[model samples]
Target: MRTDRELTPAELDAFGAELDALRERTLADLGAADARYIRRVRAAVRLCCTAGRVLLMFGWFPPTWLLGTLLLGLGKILENMELGHNVMHGQYDWMNDPELNGQRYEWDIVGPADFWRHTHNHLHHTYTNVIGRDDDIGYGLLRLFPEQRWKPFYRRQVLWATLQALLFQYAVAVQHVKLDKYFKGRISKDEVRPLQRQMNGKIVRQWAKDYLFFPLLALLIGANALAVLTGNLVANLLRNLWTFAVIFCGHFTEKAAVFPAEVLENESRGHWYLRQLRGSSNLEGGPLFHILTGNLSHQIEHHLYPDIPARRYAEMAREVRQIAARYGQEYNTGRMSRQIATVFRRIWVYRKPQAV
Candidate 1:
């Protein structure tokens, strides 16, 4: 069953040894440094959010309104991507810090922490870009890879991709519940019932905080209720769009591969690492961009070692690239605009397998 993509036994053992060494070195160094780094990032996000909300009180002023809206959007991005996303991945779990505990941490998005962990941390990371296995390929919406059998519905993928960005958080919140699958008989009603309940509670809590309480507070305080609501809407829109762009570019770039699930059955650890490298791409950026993307600019490394603290991705990238070179594997990477353009192109890339 082994395809040419599979490494020889000697190569597999060597590849495993080098990667094991990398992981061991990283694990040994994961301690106070990681805990402090996440805490600092959390503090930064909190400060930005507080400042944005306070500025929004003076939304009647044009300068303050623009700055406040921008800050609010940036703050939400930092919160969801850097602080919450990585923390809930158990990246900082070794610190044993209560607030950063993967199981206990709740993020700012409408998606329940538990549900997100189930879909993202467990499933997406595990299955990656296996054509039939990885739900994240296009989130069951668009055709982002030519390997997926195109249907009549795929003609509207451009529109679907746009709408998915605008409603990204809502889409993510409901992904794990899979009500459609249950209704279609692919999954059991009992299996989805508890998740549906959890998602319902999460929806109420998240929606109430943003769409209800904050606007009400502005009205009570004699601020422009319309402006308050609009500010929140704009902020959420910005977060959704930016997150969609970063995530899409990370996985759907031209150089990334879409594998047949059969190639991955009973896969070994080293081959699993190779599959992740082949199926993921990275964005080129400096520190600020890295922070904004939760260091997922180095997506290939994160895919290979999801549990490693996000802050360490930069250091690991060079080693990862070198190891990949030694193994003669292609490590897909590019600038943000280039990567994103390729993903967009893939929407309509319908072609034979050789064309890809």
Candidate 2:
């Protein structure tokens, strides 16, 4: 529980105004270049998907099978991270392209797009790292910070964390259901049924598309059904693992802070900005690495300006660091490997109950 210097009311106001000004500048600058970049990302996604599927149909060849799997995995990552996630954030909605409509755009994951908008765009963003309010805090399954109450179940959090990463999308799919409450009799079964039904429908559709339809189509076309099935499985696994790693590193790093619920009481805009900064970390990477991570490599900036097009984060990060420094705030960031290691260390260190 590292402490941040509490800003005085006037200082908080000034700090917030500066950040709001930066956001305005970035938003005003959004135009042809931003559109071109996202369009290019969409083009790359389509190319990877189409080519990967075509190659997988010839998966009898070892080289082709390997290539196809990697290509398909890349495609899923691009779609999930760069295209789908950003578009669904309404980043490109200003361009007036119906295809990029945040509310209507559906991603390729088993979790429904509508569910994500509520769980992520609304709750997580609004609550960031507030212990009770943010569904993302340990994702209601593990204790990554000492501020969360320890439970016997959290003793094996390292194991739970690993399993969650491997099946990350499914974990995301069930997040909105709040099964913990159901088990404790907080919510009734009837209330849970509709959400469960929606989740189940999404799972069935996703599984059928990847596991059945694609494989069966390959079989009918005289290709190896087994190969197609395995390729899709491996590709999805890759997307899940990568996505889990990137997201976890961004939020659960050693320096990231979780807030007490009381902090929300009459919190000013500057205090909110400060909380977002302290609770998020950034990963340092090359341009391609940033793109693949949806520029969440600049997670600090993303938290600060979640609605701003992520492609603009890299540039915004430089100014943000300077602003943070002037405000005497620490800007947390590190290499992906370093940040990932920190998250793992947090998981292990907080696995046991904290001493009084």
Candidate 3:
């Protein structure tokens, strides 16, 4: 059923062994550099956010306002991508820093860390691209792959994808809600009430911080309250758009593969590794770009070694590519522009039933 060449049982064992050895080597090497790197990233996030807010207080000046918005957006991106996401992955837990504890760390996004742990950390990572299990397939909205059953609703997915990118955080926030199942009457409102309450509380807190609290603070200072509010709005919008693009490009690029439920049956470690390699794509970029992506630009490595500190992914990628080549598996990767274009094309092409 697979279009790509399959590894024999012995080859699969060797492939898994190689990857496991790489992971152990990386884990053993985690030390002061890794700790310092994450700490520095955290410091950068705070610096960007605070300085951006300070600049926004004088938003009467257009240049200051524009600079403030960009800086603030950059901070949120660093937090959402570099700091928050990786920390919540337990990537820095070995540092023994309570602040970096994955189970307890809360992110700046509207999605509760606990909810995300359930939907993303556990479910999405575990099921990955399995058709029925991974809700990330289209986030219960757009039809990104031909394997998904086509619906009349998907005709508008091109537009939906755009809006989803704009409001990406909100889409992530409500992912665990499974609204589609609720709408289909498979899950009752009573069953969803507890989760709804949790979702609403987080949404309100995030809104208050960005939309109300900061703007009100500016008003008290006799600054342009409207400017502050608008800046925050635009900043969140920037974060949404960028996060959406980086993430969509990672998983939905043209060559990325999806599998069925049965593949999980007695799936060997090597087979799981193979599935991760095939199902994920990487973005080619330099250090700054990689950091901004939480090193998820190395999506293949992240999928293979979910627990290893992501800061090491770039160097680790060289070995990973070689291993894939030796096993006759393609390591899906491309420049950001090329990958994202294919993702959009896939979205457009798969909106129809049996389009190919």
Scored by CA lDDT, what does every candidate get?
0.85, 0.92, 0.92
Model 1, residue 219: distance off in Å is 1.6
List where candidate 3 sits over 4 angstroms from the true fold: 1-3
Candidate 1 local distance difference test against the native:
0.85
Deviation in Å, model 3, residue 136 alpha carbon? 0.6
* Per-model TM against the reference: 0.94, 0.98, 0.98
Lowest lDDT 10-mer window, candidate 2?
1-10
Candidate 2 TM-score versus the reference = 0.98
Q: Which residue runs of candidate 1 sit more than 4 Å off their true CA positions?
A: 1-6, 188-190, 351-356
* Predicted structure 2: lDDT: 0.92
Q: Each prediction's Cα RMSD?
A: 2.7, 1.2, 1.2
Stretch of 10 with least lDDT, candidate 3? 1-10
lDDT of 2 by residue, 328-347 (tens): 88889989889899899888
Candidate 1 lDDT by residue in tens digits, 1-356: 11224579679778878987998999998878788888998888988888888888885688888888888899999999989889899988888889889889999998898888988988899989988788898888777776787667677778888898998898898888887677779999889889888888988897788778877888899887777778888999999999999999888888888889886777878778778888889999989999999888999988988988988989999999899888877778889999998888887564223334
